[model samples]
Target: MADFDVKPSVIDRVRDRPRRLQRLAVLIVILGMGLALLYPLLRDRHGAPIEVRDVPRLPPENLAVIPLAASPTDDPRRVALGRRLFFDARLSPLGRSCGNCHVPASYGTLRAARSPGLGDQLDEFNVPTVLNAALSPYLGWKGKITSLADQLHRVINNPRHMGSNWAWVIETLSADSDYRSRFSALYADGITRSSITDAILAFERSLVTPGAPFDRYLRGEFGALTSEQIAGYELFKDYGCIACHQGRNLGGNLIIRFGILEDPFKDGFFDAATPKSKRFLKLRVPSLRNVAKTGPYLHDGSVETLEEVVRLMARYQLGREMPEEDVRRIVAFLHSLTAPLPENFR
Candidate 1:
């Protein structure tokens, strides 16, 4: 055989060293990037560990849902004052208050398909419950308002809602001795629109219902849910209901087209003449917490039963029909989501 050297010369070895180092550097960079991307997903929305009852379980990163935690720091006094204002009918010029539609006993919603507005006009969408609403990233069926304070202001001023402006709200509230006293104690500015909104928002933030069976299950209580509900939960994920409906509030964080796979509104109230931009077609996915009690369901409140809602969601959102047994199990899982109203809800 011809003499052939298998080993590279010293010069070749030196030349190859930088290439090897470059490849190793690239690998390290890729790994670092991956970890950086995954770290945020592993943490909850607030960048805190996903915890409930001091038990850290599946973070929003892993499960697409986080356990609801108690808001222990909420001021009881502020909550009380806000609760009082919430139910008072004087907030609206028409004598319809927030509570008129967002009834506490009804899981913060009304039974009507659409609530009557300030005048003869009826609201275009269903009333979503205020329970667990604090966990929602977006508010209202349209998902237009980002802040609770802004939502309150818009409702107070919207012609279809309170039909009143800041001036009227302030004047109406300022006349009340009790409100005035509470305002003075809680806020130095007292009786301003900002103060009123702050108080109401403080109360809204306190409306956290953290003790649902599903929440307990997430907190490490494995047996909190019944076997059927557990089966339903697995089915819920398997059927892709968890895609949009995830997070602590489950569905509130997302704004999706009403009919993603098939048009739920076609041949119904929404015709081709309705603009694509219209809210009737695009809406915020509502929270499922206390969903069993907050029906009539859907944005238009067209579906009356939870079972029907599940079937409709499967058809319209998932582009398929679920078996009756699967629907029953999913509904059972949803029932596990129901939590008691906050103690200060009334």
Candidate 2:
């Protein structure tokens, strides 16, 4: 070996490297300990835990046992006025009424996925039935509006729905001698935007669906539902549909993002152009009381037939592909939920 190479062995250099690494390791451990000690202090400096579940469900007295609604207000005249306004096409500048989209015969959902608004584009979401709206803890798919009155105001202003400004709505209704007189009589403070909302809300509250076959079954009417319907009800509960869709209206107690079990929106079930938050992927659970009539099911109106809806829910909500026979039976059961329209609604 060369003399220079023999002067310092490779092992000597390796030993020096180990010492350097040990010093660096010690420094890193010290730094870690300091961060661990300061972590609690940093965490405590920020926000406290928030209590979120304080809001209560609508009181029992306010809801119908089957197709739930708020208990009728003491003012009958206001409700009567509301009913007239509900059917009046004059509420819109385009001569369209609420019934134009929310066909009472169709369980409140619009025939098309979206109804034409003021613009060329269709409305974003399906026109949910006005039936049982009062039973919901919050309004709209996102639960944005809290009260029926607030919802009415937003819809009137929404160009796609009512397409009228506050001033125009007030002026339009005020000009109607009949509407102005009605508003004056119902509201203590006289006609105003607030009074208009009150009248509309009063009518909405009156749109209740009662005496359905399902209601009869709940009331111990053994023959109200056929054997297939009974089987479907069993499947509805057994498959965990009752977990989210329960209570009087059969839904609307809580806001759950859609596609909890599977991503239904991924397969083009909803409009991709809409914001992610506003898509059919997120929604409040809808009432299934009149599910049969509410055709073109789902928020995007992707599934038209009740059988398809049942299968989709089974696959998406339950995470299991349901058999066709099972789906058909469930559809039969859903049909029982369709109560004869209230005489007043007719």
lDDT of 1 by residue, 1-346 (tens): 2334534565577677868788898999999999899887766654554345334543453248778888656567777888888888888788888988889888899989987864677777788888777777788887877888888988888888777899988898899998889889988998998877877887888888889999999889999999999999999989999988988788788788888888765746444565655734667888888898899988777788999999988988999989999999999999999988888875
By lDDT, the best candidate is 1
Give the top-scoring candidate (TM-score): 1
Clash pairs for candidate 2: 108-129
Q: Which residues of candidate 1, in runs, are more than 4 Å off?
A: 1-63, 267-280
TM-scores of the candidates are: 0.79, 0.76
TM value for model 1: 0.79
What is the lDDT of every predicted structure here? 0.83, 0.75
Candidate 2 lowest-lDDT run of ten: 47-56
Candidate 2 residue-wise lDDT, 160-192, digit = tens: 888766787677777888877777777887668
